[model samples]
Target: MPKSNIMDTYGRFDVIFKKGIGCKLYDDKGTEYMDFVSGVAVNCLGHSNPAIIEAITDQVQNEIQISNYYWNDKAVKLSNRLTDLSDHEAVFFCNSGTEAIEGGLKVARKYGKIKGGNKKNIIIYMDNSFHGRTMGALSVTGQKKYQEDFEPLIGGTTNAKFNDIEDIKSKINEDVCGIIIEPIQGEGGVVCADSAYLKGVKALCEKYDALLIFDEVQCGVGRTGSLFAYKKFDVIPDVICMAKGLGAGFPIGAVMTNKRASVLTHGDHGSTFGGNPLACAVGCAVLDELVDNKILDKVDDKSDYMVSKLKKLKEKYNIIEEIKGMGFLLGLKLSIDVSEFSKRCFEHKLLLITAGKDVIRILPPLNIEKEDIDKFIIKLEEVIKTF
Candidate 1:
């Protein structure tokens, strides 16, 4: 075999995309694709959205960044909007979902140290939960594949089975300080925790004085037909970690916390480009569109339509085992290998991705058009025929 020029980190796809507009993307050869992946749920408003482009461009013309040493109007405004939308009393911005997770962990540990001393540093995480790739985030990421070589991971983290209250309760102890979970597990095959299960977790957290942290990095920012997925369950968390769609393609992440868990004093945690003006400007624009344009309500309608189509497809194709997730963040379990089905869909001009071994993850832009969805269904049907 010949050596490849590029580093082999990601499983490389052959197709090269040249440009994207709305829910469709064009390859270098001008072939078009119905993009259901949406950059793994990052491009919430679709590609090259006018509002996002205009906001980013205008901000660049004026100012792009300012150190935390000085005040930035856009950052302040974005923080205010985020805090106002949730029960959280404060917000800390960062560049990616992982950074936000890192910040959240720091806050949790700091709170433990301040209130319970250093002994109470243990944090509970779900078995299949994914926080991030960074050390602190990776430490709590319960998947072993990502942690295989990383020895001596941040200590004081334990894994409990998702949706099993007994398993979670068994793991909790006096040393535990927090319990972090994805309201809807995005990367772990789109498994949603039962509402009763979430409520039970909340009760456990309350009983043990453990902070509840919702990692809505993928299923948040109006992806689940609400500003945050926790809202759907009516369970407010002590700290909420969000990213992906918050900036609608621009790099931004935030940790939103209510007053009780807002224990970080000055100099406890900080980031260099955490709340830069440009990213916040884009974040505010995305939020305004989500709220003022009533985009949140549309998420449920579109999700229902997609689910209906998928159910019909499921009947026709025995390969499909189940459909899971809320609103637009859907997962399709397959009797066949998901990688094979995903490749078939991609070859048929429909972009898709695999979540776990046998799950087809569909994360189209929140504002995707109905026509494009219909076309995707047609293309998917064609792909399933060959599969």
Candidate 2:
């Protein structure tokens, strides 16, 4: 059969996956691969989870989607659940991480405009941090490569050095509307913000009357062994953008805020597909499993095991520079570029992804089995030997 024609945006991987279960995926020819990428950290509960399947199936049988103008029971339940889990008081659902970011940015800007005037519309973003691909989210993303082609980005965004309190202070001014940061920068080589630095940013934002926003799209939703990454640091942000793992494998996103920061009055922001019934049902199911099933407690144990295994690998292979990050959201800094290493692993029937140029991002399913980890290590060791 002739290959189906489609626009090739992503650098195509040689393997075409046909199905996945738990932490394993099968290619078109039925070759098995240990999936460490987990669709870039979207499958928190792993592939084809029975609970998620049942939830989605049940919701679809009734109402797959409905307009956002009316109330949906699933959305309402999910929102309540989210707000209860978070320190925040309200939730705004959207379709993806970028949409959630757009909602959060709009809320911050509108809050500043009404309270601090239009002059306080500036937003502080961190270098090497990623929010999403939409224009608003992309504007605040500090990576040049992603923003190179998209010139003349939305104005009012200032780049600050991550983990550098002084740099954030230098950027904050009377016009600054909010300070947005990733508590644990997932795409920026798995760098975690220092505790003092995070507290300092919060203090600066408070001093300037600017909102503190945490972009936890990758580090939130139990990925960090906590309900949220900011919670781990003991810092409270005014607004938080979450996605990736919120719905397990379902496409969903949310912008949550405290009472003071929930200033987007009626009609200020809206999404046609946001807060629909189907996604919310799946989200609630995922949250139930994460919370009630004690999945979060296991995150620390899995993370430690993975870290210990990676440390041993590092000792045997001088090519590995460091292993960083918390819980299952980890990255291995390699002395050599990760592109070649990632390709070698894929060839050996393991799926991995590269972050930046030198870091290998390991985002396996939160419930990845011990046996899968062993297989992943064997394949990884073989790839290292090839290097």
On lDDT, the leading prediction is 1
lDDT (Cα, tens digit) per residue for candidate 1, span 197-235: 999999998888889999999999988889888999889
Per-prediction CA RMSD (Å): 1.6, 1.1
Tens-digit lDDT track of model 2 for 1-387: 248588768787876788989998998899998888988889999889999999998999999888876899999999999988889999999989889899899988998897778788999899999988888999999899999899889998999898888788778887888988988888778888898999999999889888999999999999899878888999999999998899898899999999879898788998888888999999999889999888888889888887889999999999999998888889999998699888888889888898877899999888777777887888889999998
Model 1, runs deviating above 4 Å: 1-6
Give the Cα lDDT of each candidate. 0.90, 0.89
With a 3 Å backbone cut-off (N, CA, C), the pairs that clash in candidate 1 are none
* lDDT, residue 260, model 1: 84
Q: What is the lDDT of residue 369 in candidate 2?
A: 70
Q: How many backbone clashes does candidate 2 have?
A: 0
In candidate 2, which residue ranges exceed 4 Å CA deviation?
Answer: none
